[model samples]
Target: MDAMEQVGARKVTFIDVLRALPKLAPDGLRMARGAVGLVTLKPTNKESIGHIFQRAAAKHPERPFLRFEDTEMSYGQANALVNQYASVYAAHGVGPGKTIAVMAGNRPETLLAALAGVKLGAAVGMINTNQRGDVLDHSVRLLDATVLVAGRDYREALNEVDTPTVLDLDTLADGATSDADPEVCATLPASTTAFYIFTSGTTGLPKASAMSHFRWLKSMSGIGGLGVRLRADDTLYCCLPLYHNNALTVSLSSVLSAGATLAIGRSFSASRFWDDVVRTRSTAFCYIGELCRYLLNQPPRPIEREHQVRVVVGNGLRPEIWAEFTERFGIDRIAEFYGASECNLAFINALNIDRTAGTCPLPFAVVEYDADTGKPLRHGDRLRKVKAGAVGLLLTKVTNRAPFDGYTDADASERKLVRGAFKADDCWFDTGDLVRMQGFKHVAFVDRLGDTFRWKGENVATTEVEGAIAEHPDVEQAVVYGVSVPGTDGKAGMAAVKLRDGTRFDGTVMGAHLANRLPSYAVPLFVRVINEVEQTSTFKSRKVDLRDEGYAAGVTDPMFVFTGGKYVTWYPDYPAEVAGGKIRA
Candidate 1:
């Protein structure tokens, strides 16, 4: 029997176990090596990130540390630059407990400024550069930063915000000296707040998630050293913006911990991606699900498999495209993981399992949940665990070993905690995600709980529908949400789609596409032709407002309804037909 059959049976045959052996071998070796390092060269609680960089520079002064386009900075050179910036920040009284808001695109100086703040025992607020007007203003003010460091490209966006001290990145290093490492680096404790990474804020305004130095160090050792398993000679390529934790903590921390080189890209470009990999000679690269999908959609290039990339790591890789991506790109390994900026739970694909989010060492549970209310179901005041292979809400137990540092907003943080989840006085952090728990602590991510809606007595995952719609060649982007039908018992699926430039929508083609790709009940009943889909800085589609807009006939955007076995322009009579029982949802 094949893998799918085995999964259905909830049984791992000898063949299945054998298939995982090859992937497990390297991880075992890497974990063994990491164990030795953990015992022999563990970092002290008092040593800060600056001290870690200092030690790496001392050991590999001449090795390349960072590469951006044509520019390369050696460990020694980068350390010198960091020292200069640290000195400047120190002069401005940016130290312990102070917050420094940093807004910039992917640039070498951006990393330098953030490191300087960490060096001085200050919390660095990594602001998304794409934000503008009121959103940008609110972000800066929300952090209550003592200083604002704006990149040259984003000066205009900062004009509206009222900050105490605003400094330009272009001239931050002009007059500063390459002074010794800041004194605070040696004194800061592991519990000190290192930075604040904002949540993607798909449902509402973003909240600042506090990242402690202790967590950063753990990420470096856990994810970087053991998960990616990079060597000193390896160069990890990253194109995601630094404002997000995937790039800032996962990619950067791994490279620093392994003393490996980091190749930085100005931004992600599907056309230029392979060329960048070839240019940097990257041995591994970081990715998101969307980035992988974009690359897969592009026409095959001769240079696609020419690079030295052996392992690729990141989250959001869909199971449908997982095998195709690795096979097409000749990737030897993929380290797909599941984690959130604020949540304490993390699952790493250390064993190289296909389609599974791997296992977590920390405690977690998949409990029965209600689709309508988007909350875990309770049985006599006790949370119920879902059966194996059943989709349910994922919760992580909050304890000292796996603590939730939470967000800067106390109330927002409290809202995420579910007290007495399983027992009295016990607390669990709700991940707000649904997953199917596989055997051996592995999980297959299903969808966000809020995005799953009931339709036709069946639960429909918008992400699944959106993924199906995105597979169409003509569809550029798809935002799937549920709209309440007048006569229907539950919401009906509606998709807001942006087609490829200059391409026109053909309802017959789209209807056929959906029919072929998704289940009959899961297919969207309506489609809205939109110019563009609004997205968070992290590229997550905003769906709350889209759901509110629904299938309003007065809206200017052209709308279509699937009827008579094909898609047709939505007319004024469509709602009346449903109300009169002439049409069925």
Candidate 2:
């Protein structure tokens, strides 16, 4: 079987290392220097994100740096713009110890406004452009922004919020200011705050996580220079919102680190993905797993396989489609990496491993967890490490080297800490993710802790069940969540599936396929056929509302129940009957 098709497979060999070593040798020293800087970085290191950009500009002044639609700018031109914006911001009292909240779509000015703030040693609050109403108001207030920079299109949205100061992007970019680099860029320390990226508020209100200049610099060396391994000549197509870390830190930093060109996409369009890539002549691109899945779902086109894209980099590629995506798209490499916006640790596929999140040197462990309580399991007083090839909670040790620069909310940050796990006085950052150990420091991501539910004394992974359902020809998308079952020990498995147009639900085929794919306890007991599944701006399925609704009958969507080896239409009396133990699950 192919390595990716197998569960918990560890197939990396000495020869594999030999082959990968040569590939990494070209940038090995650069990565090593970055690693050393991460360890030795101090508050007095007289380095900022702006300083790094200035360094890249000095070295490759004439190199292509930013491209959006018809406009393209060299490193020299970008630095000049950054300097001009910084000077304007400085005149408006923007300096160290202040924050500039940037809320706009994925455009050149959105990024330029942020770079300007960072240039003057001010932290840039990366507010989600998709946010509105209370959530958008909270993000700006939480950051305590000194100035709010937004696109003119967001004028109505801005009217709803009470901001300290507002600068419209369309109007702000026209002002004439000095194009000389700020001296503060040289004096600002590595510890200076750079960006305040808000977390995706899937549960409640989102919290702003601080991204320091040092952390951004580390990403340049670690995820940027090392993981993606972009060449100076490479042009990376990035469409993900600049507010998110994937685009802001991973995509942008990676491009800047390599002194390469970044072709900006206004937004992600499944129909226009290949057209945009071809138009930009991009040699690489950034992606999330869902983005890749959407591309796979699109009708096959010749331009898809006929692009200059040699390697694509990002995280969250499900294993079920790993092999298929590569073969269908003719992608030579998928530089999959695993990291969070606030987490101190990172796993990058630096060696080009198949079906793994790659390697990390920082201290971490996969330990047995108690799903009922939603926490790690402790044997007596110490948490026990699960055997290799088993799914368990991922804990990253918090140390001086791998420091947890947590959220702006100190109380929220305190809750994620797991102290005294293996040893007394030791603290670890709870990743809240379950992963399978693949041995040799490589790991396969299983599912998020919140998404895993206990059923019949076994943990059911939603992603696994959803992947199986999506394999069916009639199914367009599947979202698996835990739903309450009367008299059941734990929440029963439930799935909200969208069928392809002109296709109706086939319970027998779906039940049979799921039976062959997942264990009995893992298969969803209830399947709800809906017209659409709601998703976040980043394409992640929004399950809280669906999970809240449960197996109840809806106005538009029909519900089904699995009984006697097949799914059948659920009636109103089924809930009472199941509660009365007439029909046992």
Candidate 3:
């Protein structure tokens, strides 16, 4: 925790640098090899995901490639099924430039279906399973997929949506028996679009972000081979929805890179998490911050600390809980990385740093920003870069080497561009995230630019406030957001919290606890004790719904308002402090 604050200012030790230098050389060579392979890839037969899997199967035919609770598939077996499925898919006009949208949950078949399409040079759309009706229709139509592979459970979900040729996943290969490699693999190039991973629709409709096989390979080189550093025997446990990049690219790609095993869970279950990890004999696991929080909140079981996981990887592990999560779980390294489903660049904690999002070679900037308005602070014609250690808006440069390939729609939250950022005619892609520019090419995530609010002339970060609230022993989880008051100048901070079992919400004690941790201006003005927090499939709290229903009559949850130094019952139209906004102050 102390090192987090000193990240950008700390002096590097010679011993540490010497140790890191040797490890970096292998990563550099690995990434360079991937770059060279893409350019030199044979047009007909090499470097695609399918080709990589085939090579692994040929080398390690008997090694387990995928492990589910009831199913264990060896590299040879999985590749054979993938080929069989590919044979079936190719018959339906699935080939180069065609798209195969898959609507399913995390299962062995779900991953097999995606690989089957990619083997035939078809872009696989990883559609969100939670989506239905209009959103589902838009997602399906967005790709105009030549075919759709849907699992049995999700067939009813797609019944109402307009989709392309739908194929029942289990019944797809009814008569197909060939397990040999598909002929289409010979014609596929490395640059072909491999997948269309949709963004988590926590805010709104998800966007289909296109990713080429080359980029996916780059992630394998950077995060898999270098960061997680998986071996042939390592099993990476990934419970996140397969549609997300963390699962599909980071965890799975890393496994493929090492010719290792992949352990899949149908969905996240806090109670069953450790059990799954132990059962799969996982050496590593992917995570989001919310997943960590859920685990921390649960009463410890005997197996919680006893596990084979030496290193854990993924993004959104907040600094506040980093030490606690590691200390409790006895993890050796945490590859807390920063990258989006659509972003071209990624920062991996290859050095196994404690509090930073790690380092990258690509060019990026943390420019000064107005958190409240979500605007970059510009000086004359260019946005001003933040001094090292200062929090600011994060922007990554677009280049031929690392291109910004994600699609941006008109209805997006905002135009994700910063024109003339530092020099004339140069444009940077706004990452929509606030980050601290740690020295030596390192960056630490602060909060989302949109997850901030101006109150009493001070910008309050919701993540920071949520961290403070969640730190309390009695609180299981907390989500902070800004809400409107009748006479307030700006939005006021409000929190939706879930308390631990058998714990009572004592507003006075909670208020005092927060006051000690956060400044008066940053402390949440209103607090609601909820039975449960509504979360997306990825464990991201749905803040929009909570913010929109702030202190409203429809909210049956117990609500409290900060008044003076204590909190009081908050009723509908509570306007006692609405005039002065003393609660926010």
My TM-score estimates for the predictions, one after another, are 0.77, 0.78, 0.75
C-alpha RMSD for every candidate: 10.9, 11.5, 11.4
| Candidate 2 local Cα displacement, residue 94, angstroms | 1.3
Tell me the whole-model lDDT of each prediction, alpha carbons only. 0.79, 0.79, 0.78
The residue pairs in collision within model 3 are 44-186
Residue 12 error for model 1, in Å? 6.5
Sliding window of 10 residues with minimal summed lDDT for model 2: 576-585
Candidate 3 contains a number of clashing pairs equal to 1
lDDT of 2 by residue, 355-388 (tens): 7888787799999999755588999999999876
lDDT of 2 at 78: 87
Tens-digit lDDT track for model 3 on 120-151?
Answer: 88999998775665557778988899999999
TM-score of candidate 2 to 2 decimals: 0.78
Residue 374 Cα positional deviation in candidate 1, in Å, after optimal superposition: 1.2
In the predicted model 1, the residue pairs found to clash are none
